[model samples]
Target: MNHALKERIIAQSKQLGIDKIGFTDASSFEHLKDSLEEQKAAGHTTGFEHPVIEERLYPEKIFDQPQSIISIALAYPTKIKEKPDIVRGERRGSFARASWGVDYHNVLRDRMNKLMAFIKEIAEDEAALTFKPMVDTGELIDVAVAQRAGLGFIGKNGLLITEEFGSYVYLGEIITNIPFEPDTPIENQCGTCTKCIDACPTGALLGDGRMNAQLCLSYQTQTRGMMPEAFRPKIRTVIYGCDICQQVCPFNKGKDAHFHAEMEPDPEVVTPLLKPLLTISNKEFKHKFGYLAGSWRGKKPIQRNAIIALGNARQKSALPDLLKVIEEDPRPDIRATAVWSVGEIVGSKGNPELEAFFNTLLTTTEAPEIIDEINKVIKKLH
Candidate 1:
């Protein structure tokens, strides 16, 4: 009901450098619950979503007397200016655009915190302005709130695609008791273009602005366990996240934004050399990649994905490194994945070094699963 407050907030957002801002009522998103149930029933969930579905559908369940939700979008850079130097033996792996620069969660939280403070400062009664800010880890689906807030329409890739930033944007929201005037939602702009769905490497996109999260390469990379063999090749050289769906969307052609300097990626950090990751200490990984959003799962998944990338690239020069992982790595998943990657690198070409290595490994390796993988690699290669 407060038109002036809404306008003031919108104007203040420009000063705050928020790419886009929109407001919507905090009614329950009951329509999405059925679809979410269906996805869960079909075993399509990534298991990373908020476990309680009701809390996700209804903001009021978590926030007291929520009357409106303010959605925000911050454009992130899609391309790096400086490319990492990748020579013959020093091949590098990539982190997706979302992982570029500092973690987006931290960046968005900073902006939202500023905006929340501004709202409280200008409100009729600062003490009465009850608000809850949320980033990616929030119970509410970010894209849903953004879509309803008129920031952008949901693309077939299940990403918010604004006219200005396309899908290269980070989303955040604040649930509040203020009864602000809501904005009109944007209509889906993706009419006949199935580029994102067609280009999905793992067929995760289901054509209706929804995705099978379990099959998504992005989800697979984040998973801590050994990646299924089927998804390994599809991951390619991406250690942290997958950008195929966003990259292929027609709206994203040459869509790069530099609104936030903190979101700009460092080439060496984002596209790190693959071999060093095999033996990177926890301390070294934290020092190098702890700040990025992709580092949330820690070094194990990234290390596993790096090994898979080496195998997919058939980086024969990385054979010794992969072998070293099998020999000394503490985690069984890391060791097993390296063994599979070693097989991909060595192939049918008889490597007596690999033959001798596996023959020696069979006796010393205690884990039955790892020993089985080593035997399989030896049989296949030699």
Candidate 2:
């Protein structure tokens, strides 16, 4: 493509709400292959490991007719007013700022569609070619694509960090048959900054920008069914995704943190009081979190997360809610979490309810794991 035409297309993308845009020749991601292999070998793939990723990593394989990749970045605002000093010491319910509003996958997809329409207009005027758009939903390594397209450098926290937006942005791409001039990739800017690594509660981020997904609090909270014992204490107050790494990044300092009005956090979701959450009816749960990305994991994981957060906070006010969940929740995982939370809150005073609930559960349930967990909590309470 002509340099002038390429520049115009990029400029149009920026006008469509994309913060940064650039071009790259569609090619195998050889630069990231070794690191991906290392992640797999180190068992960081966890639930995300799939054969499709291996094949798609080879860009030649992904786009048989493709000539170039157009990468775009959409900045998600993170500007929330700092909490007042009086509330700073309270137990904080954390959600990664990216997920604070409507789902980014939906938001980015809508913008990508607009960009694709713009591309189609240009293509129609110039060459008769087609373009395919892919957001986080596809198999593409979006971060690698963004880096190759000169948008930003990948930070040690395993996030794409732009000089202007830091790590607070969402990425998407368009693979087109029309070849375009490529841009130079930026150099890594994370020099001597181990803040993200040191700040991580679960130590999921390695020094080399690779993440141990199995140990990641974000992954664990969204995981269905039972969680391993080792990760429980590490979860802290994070009920959804963890933001410790991004929060500590020096690049985010002094940047605009206000979110798009559509992305504002629901007051019910921000630093949620645990007592109300545990006893929330299914209808109420859906009403409160229906539009949230966290809701995709459903009530069990979220309720379990609330229990854990309550346990960590040692909030005595949550006792009634925990008791109700322990006695009535049909999901064994949620019940198990409630039992644990009850033990954490009432401690020595937990004898009466623990005995009553344990007796009721023993007579009614047959799942070995659930029964065992309840019994364990009962023993601890005694």
Candidate 3:
């Protein structure tokens, strides 16, 4: 084992502001296959995963001659230093803490790239050393890799819970040929605590360090199509990602790390006025939210969720915007959600103008989905 080099890497990691670093052998994650297959067979997976199962299970498949995996974690701030000013009757939606910073993908990749460069600089034969760095978007399951690397234990919420930083840490890894000694894995500490499972609005967490991703609110919000009606009410105010499970975890209580300046949230961006988001231009969304990890699915999902948030809040003041969306939004899904929101706010209080508007919309709209939504809203208004 490269004990001296490993020690140097650990020291370098601290200097690079990596909160925790650990090493593990690059053996195939064979134990995870049955669980993964079970999830896939049960339709529990979000379609966003890397397509091939083999690539996810074997580090050697992706990186040549892999002997070790160097996993790193960087803690992000759980609290925003400044909260956005609240405006009366102006409803806003939130993004989860994971989405609070500049895109964690960019930040982790930058750190890994720097670490790789440093390794090359200090290595006995730089040309012989091979390294493959990956962040969240990578094929390897980050939590599994982090746990094996001894950075943390996988909590019932399906998050890596570090002793010091809790689950508020972002994870990344590099596959290398170096035979570094492995770190000891942390044992699960959840110990009959079901706070996260009991707190889940959708029951996505399966209470065994696994989750039904299809039922997870985080996945539901990112989906571009119409969100299932069952999960709509569960969303509450979050427009992008759900943090309920993380929030309720005992390990996460009052643990906030403001180590990385880039990870500090701009409150206004993370929690923005819902109405503006409903009609925000593509260019404007990119300009405002492009740097955040949550924007990966684009503005349509965010806008759709914003419409849902308006309905969830029962913000009667947003009736005009919701009505405008129903009347003129180009996207059928947005129009459909807006139609639902209108019903949620007005709720059986017959509005002649709204009834007339929907009646007209039912006649004029071409989309079957929007027409169905309009009919439902019309029924509620009566």
On TM-score, the candidate that comes out on top is 3
Candidates ranked by TM-score: 3, 1, 2
Off by over 4 Å in 3: none
Model 1 lDDT per residue over 35-77, tens place: 9899999998888888999999999899999999999999999
Q: Which ten residues in a row have the lowest lDDT in candidate 1?
A: 82-91
Tell me how many clashing residue pairs each candidate has. Answer: 0, 3, 0
Candidate 2 accuracy as TM-score: 0.89
What's the true lDDT of residue 24 in model 1? 97
Worst 10 residues of 3 by lDDT: 373-382
Give all candidate RMSDs, comma-separated: 1.3, 3.0, 1.0
Superior by TM-score: candidate 1 or candidate 2: 1
lDDT of 3 at 194: 97
TM-score of each: 0.97, 0.89, 0.98
lDDT score of model 3?
A: 0.91
Model 3: per-residue Cα lDDT over 16-133, one tens digit each = 8899999999999989999988999999999898888889999988999999999999999988889899988798899999999899999999889989888888878888999899
TM-score between model 3 and native: 0.98
Question: How many clashes would you count in candidate 2?
Answer: 3
